[model samples]
Target: MKLVLDHIGVRVGRSMHLDDISLTLEPGSFNLLLGPTLAGKTSLLRLMAGLDHPTSGKIRIDGRDVTSLGVRGRSVAMVYQQFVNYPSFTVYENIASPLRLGRRLSAAEIDRKVLAVAEMMHIDKLLDRLPGELSGGQQQRTAIARALVKEADLLLLDEPLVNLDYKLREEMRAEMREIFARHTTTVVYATTEPQEALLLGGQAAVLDAGRLIQFGATLDVYHRPASVRVGEIFSDPPMNLLAVAIERRGSGVVRLSPDLSFPLPSHMRALPPGPCRLGVRASHVALAPSSPADIAIPATVELAEISGSETFIHGRHNDLAIVAHTAGVHSYRIGETVALHLDPQRLFAFDADGRLIAAPERQPGTVSGAA
Candidate 1:
């Protein structure tokens, strides 16, 4: 179903939970609602599911107004972060319960549907086990199976994998993607993790403090953020921001700081001269030899953290603290001096109002420094 939120706003007492949010979700597309805690992701999902009402604006499905419909009135299903299940019922019974409600089917048909969804969730073997007898992940899978069996027009998942173990979470993420791809249901998934949004590879709507910050294709938003806040929120280690003055010099040179400067690309020659914030992803910072297009800075390593496949090196160049995300395990001691290379093409510049001014196009064969 095509879902539309027209300037929707939710108010609880004197506090506003959602502030004039407007967006249209296409049918059969998986839309990710991404933000940190208290960013109103859950509240927005609840509103879409008809569990809550908007104080202003309208909610439409397929161009028809459904603002007054309750949860039971809409063809929608929801799964929360918490594992919700009927403790007394077995997994098969739980998944079959929704199918039996307000509908009549032959015994064979019900059994066939139940077993199909059970197998898809990888809980077919645990069909006879009660919720109390199953592990947390198993119980959650049963809940998801129940929701999927309904074949609802819209599916709302609010961090359903948040409580699972790291390995299980990774496994479920891939499985969920495949399941959703095969179905025609419009899905609205909520999560606080930026990596989850990227992995899902769908349209992303970034929410911040009850407001919709930016909405677009996932990779487009990541590559070219609309604002500094969007860049910081979408990044894993977060985008490194440096306050600098833009000096338009002869021969297309721009000075960012006393120790850091680079030749501006031809496209950025028309940039107005003034104070601007330089934004660089940690993955773009390197310790390798400087290429002609790279800006090198001498800095002392303050801390180094090695995490299996990658190492995070925190260094200081003059008064600026720089973070270099390098591949594989690397040894570095505190106070050790090293030259950090910054690729000119990978840099982002933001105006004084924190709005993105320029984001250079990513070139082919460009290596990501951050894991």
Candidate 2:
């Protein structure tokens, strides 16, 4: 089912929930709705699912206007962050309920379909257990199983893995990707996590303050953000933004700061000298070497957090608080002073109005760079 939201708007009393949002979701493709809390991700999903009415615009599926259709009239299934399951029914029965609704399916066929989805969800061993008897992860798996077993044409998952533990969330993300790849359903997933959006790569629609900021292929959106706000939203540690004045010299030298400057890239020399914002990702910030880059700055380390295979170093550079992501285990004490290197080629420059003025060249397999 190809779903389209044509200039949809939702207003509740005096508050506007969504404002003139427009998007088209291709059939059998995974679409990611990304935003922060109260950014209207859920409200937009509800509009598509017919759980709420849009105050204006229209909703269409495959060229047919379904704006008037209620939830019961649509072939859709939704899974929420909080697991929703029948407390009285066992896992097997819960998954089979949708298949048995107003249809005559033999017990053998029902069992086959139910068990298939249960195994796919890694909850086959808990088939006879009730919701109360299962762990939080298991219970959520049961809810997901129930939703997938129906084989609905449209699947809406609203942070379905958010309730799981860290390890379980990682495991389930990979599993869900595999399951979705095998099915041809049009899946729409809403998430506030930038990593999750990248992990479930497809198309992405970024929302902010009930407005659709940008939408396109996930990698394209990440690499070529439309604005500074979009770049900040799509970054994990958040993009490091710095206020700087650009000074263009006749010799092609561009000064970014009083003490920092480098030869401007061939394409950037055309920019007029003025004030702009520089955006750099944490991964692009590196520890100073004996022979550092020309744009190195002295900074004092404030904090260091080591997790898994990376260390996040937070420090202060002049008046700016900067974060650097480095691979492997590293230790840094508070008050330690270190020089940081900034690669001009990997930097992004935004105009005074927060519009992207320059973007770094695209490189494969590099998710952390200018946008």
User: Evaluated with TM-score, which candidate comes out highest?
Assistant: 1
- Residue 41 accuracy (lDDT) in model 1: 97
TM-score of each: 0.94, 0.93
Residues 54-131, candidate 2: write the lDDT tens digits. 999999999999998998888888999998999999999999999999679899999999989999998999989899
**Model 2, runs deviating above 4 Å:** 251-254, 289-294, 368-371
Query: What lDDT is reached at residue 147 by model 1?
Result: 93
lDDT top scorer: 1
- Please give the range of 10 consecutive residues that has the lowest summed lDDT in model 2: 288-297
- By summed lDDT, which 10 consecutive residues of candidate 1 come out lowest? 362-371
- The residue pairs in collision within model 2 are none
- Cα-based lDDT for every prediction: 0.88, 0.86
The residue-level lDDT of candidate 1 at 61 comes to 97
TM-score of 2: 0.93
lDDT of 1 by residue, 1-371 (tens): 99999999999999999999999999999999988889999999999999999999899999999998899989998899999988899999999999889889888999999999999999999999999999888998999999999999999999999999988998998899899999999999999887788778789999999999999997788888899998888886788887777677775566656866777765566678777787888888888955777888788999999876789898888777888888889999999999888887778889989999899786665424322
